[model samples]
Target: MSWHPQYRSSKFRHVYGKAASKEKCYDCVPITRSVHDNQFCAVNPHFIAVVTECAGGGAFLVIPIHQTGKLDPHYPKICGHKGNVLDIKWNPFNDFVIASCSEDATVKVWDIPKHLLTRNITTAKKELLGHVRRVGLIEWHPTANNILFSSGYDYKIMVWNLDSNEPVISKPVKILDAHKDVVLSMSFNTDGSLLATACKDRKIRLIDPRSGEVLQEASYKSHRVNKVLFLGNVKKLFSTGTSRWNNRQIALWDQNDLSVPLLEEDLDGSSGLLFPFYDSDTCMLYVVGKGDGNIRYYEISSEKPYLNYLMEYRSHLPQKGIGVMPKRGLEVSACEIFRFYKLIPTKSLIEPISMIVPRRSESYQEDIYPLTTGAQPALTAQEWLNGVNKGPLLVSLRPDSRKQLKVEKKLPKKENMCLSNGFDVFECPPPKTENELLQMFYRQQEEIRRLRELVNQRDVQIKQLELKLRNLCMNTGSY
Candidate 1:
């Protein structure tokens, strides 16, 4: 074959990372100082949520995606957790819903308002209290709605089905007690049929989430695995950890047979933990170290030499954490294959880095932009819990196709739904006659008058309290 090619010739071989301008980045964010290896940031198309440092309780700031640049110091936050917030994940199916786990040994689900937040939200839509110790990890089921998995310091994994309207789930649907030590990381297979966990005990276990059974377990003597991920399409498991020599290493394994890795590569002897993020559509793997300013990426294939090094993107500021935007949220116009929100703790900034595939054509690149997982769930929580297995719904990335999908998503159904905390937004028929309109106006006027009276009463009470405080201070000679 003409002496065989020295390197693989692929369209993504020249992919490059582009950091967004300072004007487009989020600044002055008080990122959390927790020593946990969790990503401190989570992003969706609608908003970017970042865990922040707070007193008394844990809090996270939710900023509208379009409202970039310097954030307000007094911006509203979700501050319901009694302990430090460890991890937060947005529901794959619902953009307005998010679940957060904290050191308080509880997991809370919050319903975010569609509009910008104007006040602190101290209450969660639902609270889960099954963990006996601090919860470190929480993940939403990939293809199912209302299914959540949490791993705590108690070395137990709890699966919750949030199909019902209950505000609290004190009991989980299933509890997996396989790990003897703290769980370091977890990942679910393609249809979410199998769960893989890397634990502090130096073992990786494949578990059946529905039945709470351990399907497979393997531990390499030379590797201390810290993070794990499933290459859904390739039927492979990937991990990052340290070798016996304390050098960082990455391993790839067959999901069914983890006795030996298909490939193992040793990286530098950096102390920072490597966080691995893989894009199923593009077959790309991005490895970002916690305290490093460079992102090394590779192309994963099913053939020999499973991991092929592509390129590395370097920066001056190291990233404390990172959040990945979904494939659907990428800019197809810019040929952006992936986007990452890099959290810079020293500068208190969140920067968006877009990985672009340079193509001259302005037209949509159909080969690169394949039909990816859409914003719909393939199975309901009940269906999944009942042993149903299905892949995620896929949608096109073409402009016209995306517009059509958006239109279809906006079409309202017949059922009137109520969110948590009895928050209801009802669609009512308009007044049919002038008399009805007049009656509605009169009712509103009466309510306004009553509110004004309540305000006046509160004002008088405040004045009386001020007078009493002044007199008391004078009596004590403290004024």
Candidate 2:
């Protein structure tokens, strides 16, 4: 087709039906995107969110993959925040209600539904003034839907009780200094017990949300922290950093002992986490890497405290930056991602939804593709040599099962023998069809016949050359 998947023909049912009806609730936290959730929600693999221009100017926007359904009658101008919108998020309980933060120091709540965005009501949810600089992030409480948190360049993290549109405690509940330096990132744990913040101070300080007291701190000098996440099951935290260190680092901080990392693994050469979210149901952490041009899904378990580098998905967007949302429900692993580009204050977010669904990413496509050592799941040293399906990596010469390498001691040299794992080892299993063996025989004979015919042709050509040589000799002798 001449058009991209965004313009190509597709159906919503085809997309939604692909998600299995499995629903598991992940702890509410920020994430870049979740494929496990996308699969459940039925989002198309290439349907990543962009401040992207659709075929419709701004009137109505297509949801990426399946061609023509418009999200709203018209996009809401959302013009209250006097400056650029640094963050935008939807309320978990209410899909129509969205909240956006701006350098103008105002967080405006826009109640807009997909079908009718006409109720474009812009209410100044809360105007936090203490942060002399721009607000960096705004996150809602995982369980307490109305409670919100905003962290900023002023190095302070504020907790607000957005209990009502006009509240008694509309002011900051806690304005605690999150770091010794500028606080770059901050988020609440799944349980709301701890808040993990990644700072320019090169540290991840765990603070109690209620009192705004520093509960624990995990410091590292290898690289400055960009984003820190409190992983699923409430036992560990995941973090991402820059090029000075392994661009993507999964530091599993034991909840019991927050000082040292139980498992600190690098994402090979992958750039720092563009955004990351944890799937409470699958215990998977999906990370979107910065300009590295791929979205990676990693599985982190508190029980094991080790990150299983799962898969890497290629994105069709030319986005320089992005924000992600975790799979709200459980039927799948796909997460929602919004890709856009801009600079300066540098604040964007991947939010959370209460509903559960599969994730959307290229990995869900029905085709096989190559993977790097990091993208491939880690196999035990024995599994790689054993021809097990940790993943399809072993090379086999046999047509049926993969062949195993066997070392044989010959008279003078060692002979390397490749053995069949299952398919051709001993007596063949029952054939699928009655003519299967006959079909194989015919195929073999056809190959052999073709080879023999080529040999015979060569022989005839040799004979003809001999006759020509003999005639030439006779002619010379006669001369």
Candidate 3:
């Protein structure tokens, strides 16, 4: 007789989800009514930005993370897009910077003020115009600073370098034009060396962003992938889609070989699209479906039966969209390893759900809270564009480490106010006199001019390097 183990013993087996109280949630939010299947909210340790409905143009509200509860009806917004906003993402390196794409076929990068907002912001720090159709997806490079990727209905992906001090970038550094249909989802590998994408053409592609070359492609008649995610630290790719019989399904594939999936499992008969989020530190994957109230999580392993079902977090109110907080934003003292901000449009509220590992002791759990990707970038934009690949900087989540982070985030005494608990809690003092306000405006103008001059110099150097490279290729007959 053959013996087989039915269940695996693990510490995370008892992990459960807990929702925040009503007063802790954000209420009375005018969530966008657009039917796009994208997450309508973007969050970081500092702020929560949600796409809202507007009459004349597109706009999104940026609320301070700590200011939870009911919001005023006329709260300030960041309104500039001439069309409906499709997606928004916070820069991984800089919490004060964010990028948004819209049906206007433009991508705009905005810099939130160091202090809380008082009026609507109608200007963007930088505007990128490249796509000929409505842009739907935007993602920042995981390890590089000032690098962003965006895809649109044109079936092309544009890689932009925001490092340039220029106010507008008319041309992108590189373009990946391999997809024949709209790209559904994109994920980058651990070192940011490769990109995996799922498209509406029923194909999965692995591409080298540096050279605009497709490294590998796979398609299965049984699966129609809607979302793709890279399992960092593990050389595998996971995707969620639908099976031929209209059942939701998930599959795991080896990063190197895409001929066949390592495992494929059918979920249910739900028609809504599934969004997958992975936590590399805990090796946990959360799958949330659109128009559903349940969040299913699983543990991933490199051994046999690679994907193990952990449990599900069920709720009565369905989520219109969801935002995930970075690992640094989690509360280590409470044994919280992950958090989800669910957008409940029906109630006009955003609720916080904390995923905690059951523990009785008050001390920190070092085993569960391992070193995670920090808020620092590993490389600069120019280095990444020049064929450099690096992983994100890792930081310890110990209480002492968090205190040090808080100290580093301190602002100048003259411009500082205080928050009771949040890491970034500094306020800028209002200008007392008209003379002081004038002086501040002139200083900003001067800084902008200086940056423009620096950008011009950098552009000249880049052009010189391109000329030299072309000449070298011509001499070697490789052009």
Candidate 1 lDDT by residue in tens digits, 364-471: 899998889987899999999999999989988785663466456674643444445444324323555553454345445544755696799899999999999999
Off by over 4 Å in 3: 1-6, 402-479
Comparing candidate 1 with candidate 2, which one achieves the higher TM-score? 1
lDDT of 2 by residue, 361-447 (tens): 623321111121111123332332233323212221123221122212122222222234435423234345433444345435544
TM-score for each candidate, following the candidate numbering:
0.84, 0.53, 0.84
Model 3 worst lDDT run, 10 consecutive residues: 420-429
Per-residue lDDT tens digits for candidate 3, residues 27-100, read: 99999988998999999877899999998989999998878999999999999999999999999888889999
Q: Which stretches of candidate 2 lie over 4 Å from their true place?
A: 1-74, 113-115, 118-130, 164-170, 243-247, 268-273, 303-305, 316-318, 321-479
Worst 10 residues of 1 by lDDT: 421-430
Residue-level lDDT for 458 in candidate 3: 95
lDDT of 1 at 325: 92
lDDT of 1 at 157: 96
C-alpha lDDT of residue 353 in model 3: 96
lDDT of 2: 0.47
Cα TM-score of candidate 3: 0.84
